[model samples]
Every structure is written in structure tokens, then in C-alpha cells.
Target: MTGPIEGWAGPASLGEGSVLTVVGAPHPVLARLGDPVDPTDPAVIRLAADLFATMAVSPGCVGLAAPQVGVSAQLFVVDVGAHPKTATLHGSFALCNATVVEASRWRPGREGCMSVPDLTGDVKRASRVVVTGQLPGSGQSVTITTDAFEARALQHEIDHCSGKLFLDRVSSAHAIYQRKVYL
Candidate 1:
């Protein structure tokens, strides 16, 4: 699936072909780890843009990863500024080859995914985190330190790139619940 990035028109205003069909649970690509993307590549830039677009249009979706859109690349975009639970307002941004450098404290919270639309689960996540990654086109090193909802969102998206789902981290199978609503 190597090619140039494409764009589409949407409320997110990113471009066409960016608001991709989010792959669902049990899809082979969603369960497979993603490869590192060349941040300087034009295609990667397009992917980043698509990711941002997809996130913007997805209700209650503050983050999105390459795997979710069926691209096996280590890329994701996040924006928690509009979230009511957001503690810190960081504007939307994209990253490739992201890694968590520091994490501390653990707490449980309910989480849902576009990939796993039928379910939501209670999972434990780090309360604070520091993530490092290459910026989309600049290829510059960017580090992010965040807590609360943003931290949870980051970890969730990064997990997708690593082939892990919130279902894998749920405290127990019983904690999983059917999602009747998505917004």
C-alpha cells in the first residue's frame, strides 16, 4: 500500500482521501504492528494530513493512528483541546515513529475505539507520559509531556501502532461492555 497521499473534503478540513475507512477489530492490519514511516516522504505528509482529518471528523475521537486507517505505518494525530475532560490544551499535531519515553502512575478509565466500535472497556493507563517522535514533514524530533485525558489518548493511539488494543489491556474480560452509542 505504498503510494502518494490523497485528500478529501470534510468538516475537519484536512483534505480528501484522508478521512479513511477505519479498520475494525480482528482486521489483520489492526492486529499487526505498524512500520516506521519516513517522516520526510511526501506520502507520509499526506498520511499525517489524513490522520488529522479523520480525527477531526470522528466524534469524541481525539486521536487516530495509521493502523486504524489500514496503513501499516507508525503514524498518528491527536488533538485534545476540544475535549471537555482535557486538562491541558495542546493543539492538533501529527507524528511518526512515536515512542513513550516516560510514564508514571496508573489509573483506570473507560475507553472506546473507532476500530472496535461495538465495544468499550475499562483499562488502566499511565497518568503522565512523555512521548518522542518525528514531526510529519520536518523530520524534527518532538517530545510531548502530557497527563490526564491527553495521556490516555496518546497511549491508546500508540498502542494501535504496536498491535495492541484496549481490549488487550482491560482489567478483565468482564469489564468490556457493549457500546450502544458512539459520539
Candidate 2:
């Protein structure tokens, strides 16, 4: 999945009561995947909008979730368009009530997270995945099947909604990497 590099200045921090909460290691909301969006509620739209904004401004970020910003809703945003390798991705998706309907049997992939800054780990993930979710504002449900990096990115964001970080799924702490610079 590739697309143009539309510049979006990500948000600095999750606003108070705005859903991007960093609850310690295991948050209850993070444990449970989110529910479908009503689309009629203004708060959900606002949270989605803020999440998009946050992802846009954060340098090198391909996706973001409501839990990352403290919101507990089943909402997340993804864009792989900027990745030079996955150029077919338009790099923009606003997902609500996202769920992985299918996944390929596979080993692990190196993964990272925005909530847990400066750490990377070899987290197990499906090599391929089919996901179903709605586009924010539009209330239109879209399902896409993806593999490789796109698949990995989607799974990472979905984990955030379920309160599961990449570190939690890592097979070994020795596989984790430390960030040398802030992107």
C-alpha cells in the first residue's frame, strides 16, 4: 500500500479526557477490542479526527489508535503510502470497529509502538490478514486483505485497541531494540 506524502502535523499530546490515555502496562480498555462506531455521535467523530491529526503530526508514524491517545473506542488510523517500498498503498485509512476476519499462519515480525516509545521487538503476527472496518464519518464498512508490511502495521494498531502492545507478544526480551533517535 503506497500513496503520496500528504503532510499532517501530528498532535503533541493526547488532550485531557481525549482517549489517548497511557494506562500502565495493562489497561482494561486495551485488553478488550472496541465496538462499532455509531457514526452519529459527535464525540466519536472528534476522537477519530484528533487521532488522524495526531498520526499526521507524529514523524514516521504509519498508524495510530484511540487507546494510544487515551480513547477506549475501537478506532484507529493507518497510512502506508509514505513507505517507499509499499507505494501502492494510498497511505490513508480511518478505521472504526476494525476486526481481523482472517489471518495467515506465520511466525513473528519486528514491531514497535508509539505508546511504548523507544522499543522494538520481534512480535508474532499473521503474515497475511483480512480486516473489516468502517471509514470514519462515512460509516461505510470496507474490508481489505493485505500482506507483509501493511499487514503488520494493521495488526499493531489493532493490538493497541485491545491493550496489547508488541512487547507483550514478543517471544524474548532479547529481541527488543532500543531507539537511538526520535523520529
Give each model a TM-score. 0.88, 0.79
The residue-by-residue lDDT of candidate 1 on 1-183, one tens digit each, is 111112212223323545688889899888888998888898988888888777767888888999999889999888777777778545677778999999999999999999998899999999889988877766778777888998899999999999989999998889999998635
Q: Which candidate achieves the best lDDT against the true structure? A: 1
lDDT of 2 by residue, 1-183 (tens): 433223322222222223343344455665666665664366876787677676767777888888776667788888776765452453566677888999997767666677767677888788788888766565666777777778888888888877678887888879889966845
RMSD of each candidate? 6.5, 5.3
List runs of model 1 lying over 4 Å from the truth. 1-17
- The list of candidate 2 runs beyond 4 A from truth reads 1-35, 85-90, 105-107
